[model samples]
Target: MAEEEQCNQFKKYQDYFEKQSDLMKKYDETLFDRWLHGEKGVIDQPPQHQGERRCIDFNCCHSEMDSTYSMYCQTSRVPYCHQHYSYTRYLQPPILCTSNPGINITTKFVHTSINKNKTPVYCMRWTPDGRRIVTGNEKGEFTFWNGLQFNFACLSGAHDTAVRCMTWSHSGGHMVSGEQGSNGSSSIIYWNPSLAPVVTLKTAHSELIREVSFSPNDLRFASCSDDKTIGIWDFNKQVCEIRFDESENAVYSVDWHPTESLLLSSSKGKVRIWDPRLKEKVGMFSPHKTEINKVRWNKNGKWFLTCSKDFKIILHDIRMFNKPLMIFEKHMKDVTIVNWHPIQEDFFVSGGANGVIYFWDTEHSKPIGEIPVAHDGAIWDLQWHPVGHLLASCAHDQTTKFWSRDRCGDSLEIKKYQGTNRDYDPIIPMYDDDLEQPYLAPVFIPNQINPSRINGFHDI
Candidate 1:
């Protein structure tokens, strides 16, 4: 009687796996991990035989012992495991802007500060459609603002703690946010386009989450934390696929490549590049003298920017990162925020601890224009309008400010001279003494490759 009951249990398990195999083939293998994790409310319970080693293959019904490679799948009807299964390959074609607004840089723009919340603003992002702007505050409220008029649209209680980081999916179908850790607990929430909470992933970290970024494909997203780890999460599954626990200190920021699987992360004075598929870091370099507050990728994916508490912003070309292509040292205080133009890839802006916002053109080492006092306190976040003309900034002063160029503003008047000098007269040649100096033949020095700067470049 015992043997008969055991045989019946095996038959039940076989039938369950056969049904799963059919479902997996129709949906693809990515769902397999989700099913295992019991996410999306699709499966109410975990598999029964926890101690048994089932085939790892998506379509497999046979046990690990049945396959020579330790995995058996119904599709192949053969022995296979992770070693034989291929990783998913993702391709991202160039998503380039067709129009160009040539060399338009000026800080003489109209501006206003809005105080929708009494608490300080910690993070902000423009909606994917460019119709609304969302500002997350210290009180965990998300205030929506009209993208054009900068007026309040709506507000929602998004979290129980301060919303320290937030990101919208590329397709605008979903949004994710994280809160600063308090009382030894932190949470991450997923929302729909209407700001309605879909899932509240509680106790995501014991320490604060510093940043959250979505991948180019929008299938996966990454989160970095004060816990000194970077987590790769599946968007549909809402499960952490991998945790990179290699950082020596707190991870301050993370950004995915605009068109590739590459990920950039910053810690204390150090930056690392990671390839998520291989589950390993591919590169490392120390570009800042102190803690790096942020690292961002240009839309073109050829250049990236890093801002540091060292009071400097350094731009690096992806092809050659051994040395920075340009370093802007105009900030009088710690550089806290950096933002790239939405349309003009060469133009970017940086905000400092001194409340100053400086507009920069990558072609020049100095800022193209300056808003000497853009805010009253440390600027925590900066963003550009979808059209790339208007700028918005939030600071610890408990206010958010919008800046736009005066259509008739004199571009020449805002053109700053290079180096430690302040504003220069456009009509007067500031380097007059250099005009009389003897001309020397330009030297063509070759760039040297520093092999030690990166750990695993071949994988990139």
Candidate 2:
């Protein structure tokens, strides 16, 4: 019985071996036939043009080829290839500040984000928390964007005319905007973030408003106009408490002292410092041969800086009231705008019609650095970011640029828009048939000159 059982077990093993051999033969035949006929099931063919090595694994299909490999195959026409890819390199600009080290100016700058728009940007300001940015444009529109997402969170019409100037209340609860019209309907409007104007002060001016600024305390604000007057308004009372009419030309700019209860106005060619509490001009500084375009106070309020069409920037010590402590005369064209660094009181920036910007350090009495081609055309305005070391500039080229204060080497064109478009072609030259020498005596040809008639037309 034992012998019979052993023999049966051996037969069972032999039958199992035969079955395995048959299965192997069938799989080999099927694979061979498929390879020969090029009919493998849905082969993720290794993409042609992979420059070097081709993947041949049955499960690893060519459909998973990288973008570089696909592009290489399409452009090079190489079949079933793979190669190491190289990345394009860029030279980055300098960074202004970094936490790894204390304040240093030579760090590498990486552009974190960019915001674009279709309308020309007039002004930009960051909210107190630095989470949102507000921008005013020539279309009389105001837009707010969250700094991270670059999404427009709110849009509203802040003025009927072009919104020429804007200022945020110190409390960050609302903003004040001045427009370019002077009717009763054209008044300074104050609006909250909800797109609603909560206070509209209708103290009329005879011409367009040029500038508006909020006091450091936020309880008061000032607006100047081509009417040659500056109106100081009380926010709580919503009334023009004082009107300064000392300027002979339009008041172009106004700035409040950092700590004092004084206001400064630049108009014509003079800078006037006014005491709002006393409601009178405390002092006047006339150091420019042309119009004074901008005035900015230092962080400590002990001194202020002014720039003018004379291509000069003057630093004035408020206590002396005699002459400027320093004069920057390096600009080649009109100095259109100036701004003081928010963190460094002695450092400032100036922009000009020459499309250049000067980074000035007051202590050194010279420009620390210069950026040429800052704008495509004349720069109209500039402001420093309240917290970060960034500066914003706008120009007639219909673009706004941002520069790093800590890193003067880096700059970025932030936004661009179309300016006014006008047509000039006509059917024909209008003056083609008109007399060309009517304003001058015909060159007196010796024979054609009638001396007797010349005396009668002497007035011509």
Candidate 3:
């Protein structure tokens, strides 16, 4: 019965596949169909060209296989059959976080969970209780890892294609995930704590889904996609309450304000702010010179960060939308992901395409500490642990890593103003004449009111 259902799902999209471009048709002929047909394990394919490197799998005679079907272990740099390569890659030592305490916080290497199928982890988040880390992967599956031991717990298939994005409600009562539209259909699946799908919204987007974010109240969530639309959904109704189609280009990322009704979506170089109450865009600004890959709101929602292909990360204050609060541009490659410290709002970390992870303090423009090498490939996602002592990152290298506090007994904590709940010093101090000036207030001169402003409105 299950096989029949799977075939029906495949057949439903058959016409869409048939209408694809010639390049896509070639992919369908070579690999796509076989993968969806439940073909698993190391595949043997005809070599496209002769190469010196051969599979290093024990006693395996398959040599010079097509590079598309075989890959070398990122750490070992030795070729292996797909199966053995995944095994070896996951066994490689964790990359440690090396840093000099600027704000007195740093991270060290922790254990990693192995994906036996070599399914690259695309998105991950710690359960609200911080007991387990759930990862959505390229295989449309979810793998749960024990938070303490950092070992695999279980796996569940959730989609028919890549699980592109996912988010957990603030209370952990609900979990939602979105998928790539490889079969001309994308879906959003709401799950229970046990990893069982409770509600499935098929064809949620016309193109690949980029992100799904839950509001702070958890009453509603938002999803954005390459279809150039954002959907506001009410999970109780399992329907899209509103669809935003103002973006002129493909939307790559979306995030809900941690404590507000505002929704943020990034398309090309611009970020637009939408208020669900208004059902229209309230503000839009171009923060980067190129495509912005990700945008995240701080827990307080008063500040947010955006990283882009321009190799820069900008911090913006919600009140001051016209200008950035700080611009951090130390990354040598395109910065892929930025995660704020769960407890220390003044500090955050970023991972780059060159595999370098940087620790930054908003008070300074430079990175305080860094992991010169965090992965063998570009980092796809990053999430700080709930309490802020640990960090988790996944990358194109086909592995997920954990990092924890590096030192045991140091006073590795930042101090903020007394009698205040804020996590940062609200005022910037200036250094002048060997003395720190807490305030350098700008002088202002009053100007006469415009005579044209009669009682209220101005007319052309």
Report the lDDT tens digits of candidate 3 across residue range 1-460: 9778656655644654577676456645544456557662112332122123221121111222223122322221222112222222221111111111222243455555669898678899889877788888999888888776677889888899998898889888989999997666799999997778899999999889999999888989999999889999997899899999955898988999988899988888999999999999999999997989999898877899999999999999989976999999889899888888776667788999987788887877776556767788898889866655567889888899886542212211311110001121211223345333222211112222221111110000
Which residue pairs in candidate 2 have backbone atoms (N, alpha carbon, C) closer than 3 angstroms, thus clashing? 48-79, 48-80, 49-78, 49-79, 50-81, 50-82, 95-107, 96-406, 96-407
TM-score of 1: 0.67
Best by TM-score: 1
* TM-scores for all predictions: 0.67, 0.62, 0.67
Residue 379 lDDT in candidate 3: 89
lDDT score at residue 209, model 2, on the 0-100 scale: 78
Alpha carbon RMSD to native, model 2:
26.8
lDDT of each: 0.68, 0.59, 0.68
Candidate 2 local lDDT, residue 85? 13
Q: Compute the lDDT for candidate 2.
A: 0.59
TM-score for candidate 3, residues paired by index: 0.67
Task: Provide backbone clash counts, one per model.
Answer: 1, 9, 0
Q: Model 1 misses residue 38 by how many Å?
A: 74
Looking at model 2, report the run of 10 residues with the lowest lDDT sum: 418-427
